[model samples]
Target: MTKTTFTGQRHPAASTEAENSVNKVPTETTMNQGGDSSHLSFQLTSHKLNGKNYLEWAQSVRLAIDGRGKLGHLTGETKKPEPGDPKMNAWRSENSMVIAWLLNSMEAAIGKPYLFLPTARDVWEAVRETYSDVENASQIFELKIKLWKVRQGERGVTIYYNEMVSLWQELDQCYNDEWECPKDSVKAMKKEENERVYLFLAGLNQEFDELRSRILGKNPLPTLRETFSEIRREETRRNVMLKLDSNLEGKNIDSSALVTAKNENDKKKKPWCDLCKKYWHTRETCWKIHGKPPNWKKKGADNRGSQAFQSSSEESGLQPSLEVPPFTKEQLELLHKLLQSQLQTSKLDPSTPTCSFSQTGQGLGEDDWQC
Candidate 1:
């Protein structure tokens, strides 16, 4: 018998001839075949049990995928995407999974058409299904609720709920029925208290954040050793409190009201006024304080007169006379003469010529005068 070759390997002569003689074709193994060969045909719109309508299901997913990109190319024989597409950030559903799952949940619940926000269970499950790490995905839902509360404006919530049961009950009742929530009787008072607390907290947080940013923004954040010395230098007197040691306890004076004003004297560049202990530079620049010190006028420059500087500031819409450079004795004398001249000019009759003009005319005879 003559030998036959199969992919360069010799096969039994009789077996190879019988297989190759009739068909002249190659048969591929199950591993080499493409796709889910178990059930070759399928419809995307229908879930396994036909739980969803074909058109609507397809449209929803299409819309969702389209928001991020064209997911149409995903199909059999294709490799599964290794990671999420970055472009989907713009197409984010915000709470798409939550809303979709809610639609299904409500459809089953009331067993009819009903307008309902997604319940917590629906949101949780949807996120769980979408992301392998469910814990991280829950953050998106929380943020969605926050956005919803903000959009509701005056009806926004201030309380946090541990479970969905109470929250959903409130939301469902509010949406479905006419129910009035009791307004906090002490709201205005609470608002003022809250504002003070918030401001204090915010300022404290800002101080820490500024320090944190300065420290952490470097290529490598500072170590304890690098930061400790500077931190001590930055401390205020009260930072290391001079409390009567609680060990020798007496009355604990409330230090709550001990607030200090920032000294912005350098910003105003004004002279310090010991009397007011406020720095708008000096009493002369302290428009809000009113009733100046006896020598306030003596201290300020009379160069252009108060009104002249004040008018200039008004023209520029600036506060009157910002911290001006201090005048020496000679400069002060020159300023005095300058002010007197301005005042005299302001008071002069329109018909009269200036003193310089009148003097020049008197000194020069008509024969000596020329244009």
Candidate 2:
């Protein structure tokens, strides 16, 4: 009865079970520690919360934390374990990591007070109470004003669509209401979607007028996404057409400029007449050969003719001719008598040289003229 034995080693099954328990603890701890360490420098979003953007910042943080499977820490769904519990260390470690992430995602002044908070949920609630203004009518009015004014002016369709969607999402969050009946909810959702479609169409640039009309003409109006796709396609097509039109216009302008320059050069190269001192004609076709017209003075032809005559006389070393008055009948008879008397005197005195006129009746013959 006194032969009870106590051994340092346990049964094989017991030892294996104990070893498994020890391995499981370390494995779970390592996994949690690894997860926590990986996200040590993680920022939820590029936009830091500064009280004014609390709604948007909250949405971003929720999305990021949910992605990491740690949203429960912020929502209080993941409860704190008892002090001596095996999971207590991992829970505390993960909670602390989440708190760090939240702090990092906030503005320094806005996040400092939350640094000493006990848990992530406490920090989340504190921030919410301080900045969440979902029920504020002023906020709703401001959001409505922004939505009303959003337009596609100068921005690409995708950019405009993104901005509008962001505003819609924020506005929706502000007016989140749960319906009692599924049918009513569906109907309400459809109505809201239709209203959004109208808003989107209205905010488009006038360039999309035809497409917008086509979309509105449909019996059962297209969904917002479908309308957006159609509009996006149209935008791409318009861009291509505009580029082609600009290219064609540029080519036409270049061709017209070239033609104009060529015409100017051709005019510059035309023959000039010395007799008329005018462009586009030679001495053969000058007005002097054709005889001066009646409207020469009215048409400035007399001035041109005078300039040409003056230039030609200068070149030929001759004096310009002056206009002579018409002789009256008596004056002509007197001139003829004087000429006959002078001729008779010249004949009586053969020593005087006589002058002869040329066939043109305008100048003396070269042989009859003295130097």
Candidate 3:
């Protein structure tokens, strides 16, 4: 809008007093300074966009970046875990913008823990680009809230989430809660986990008589979850080993927890040896059968004080020949979280009452046991 003013002195005309008439240009609104409304109109035509469009739309998000200059995520975003330097857990507590975005990303995608590591980086970038503009776009600052409904088509284990999201939800809830899943399903997963573990241990055995016949023909393919589980177990085993070593140097390394050893002549049979052809020995004591000299020390073998025991005529001291694997910090954290959540949920379960027969049967003799 323009300001209008009438000058006091008017031009004098000869016949009649003629007043000057002029029109002031209508003022332009601030919206015309930088052309944006036009492009915004075009942007609304598309409902679903790709990663590129998503990034462009980020410039319109509302930002509350702190003194550190990090921006908050869109309101409708589901949170994801912050996959950062493992040592930065404590650091993130003071950085709410990072944590909040991570959480939103996780929630939005229902992402698996393994998937979050890579997605976390993109999430932060998305939040930053979404909030570049401070005004005129606040109404659409938040990400779109597109939703979908799950419907059934056919029954099978091979269907994708788009077809079976609801079924998985029922199973996934057990991640934290101990609800009763169908016995068949629980039994099946447990059986699968155990069978996978057994096959893995069997594969580790160096002296399987028919490794090719049993394994190569079977064509077993390890799953992402199974591989992850084994990786975690081995890692925890390594951690326990390291902790034991740090606390027990100069002490005997106990193999009981790791592997059991016993003589065949003992009351019960012990786990057999791969190298030895005897009943009373393990792979550790198999030198007697392998015909190796008692003092024999294999080259490149772990010699963790095994030399302290002098070899007989040809018995090498037992040592760990297998390479130990290390665990990632995230795996350790996941295990700890799983255990803690399980423990908390277990304590919340109602106890089953037990009744004794002796406490019942008023009409019966005191000597009778009847409920």
Against the true structure, whose TM-score is highest? 2
lDDT of 1 by residue, 275-313 (tens): 668654676556557755566665454544444546656
Error of 1 at 215 (Å): 4.0
Residue-wise C-alpha lDDT for candidate 2, range 118-196, written one tens digit per residue: 9999999999888887567888798899999999899998878777776766666565366667677767777778888
Highest lDDT among the candidates is held by which one? 2
As for lDDT, the candidate ahead, 2 or 3, is 2
In model 1, what is the error at residue 4, expressed in angstroms? Answer: 58
Task: Estimate the Cα RMSD of every predicted model relative to the unseen true structure.
Answer: 32.5, 20.1, 41.6
The window of 10 residues in a row where model 3 has the poorest summed lDDT is: 14-23
What would the TM-score be for candidate 3 when compared with the true structure? 0.14
Supply candidate 3's per-residue lDDT for 244.
82
Score every model by TM-score: 0.13, 0.60, 0.14
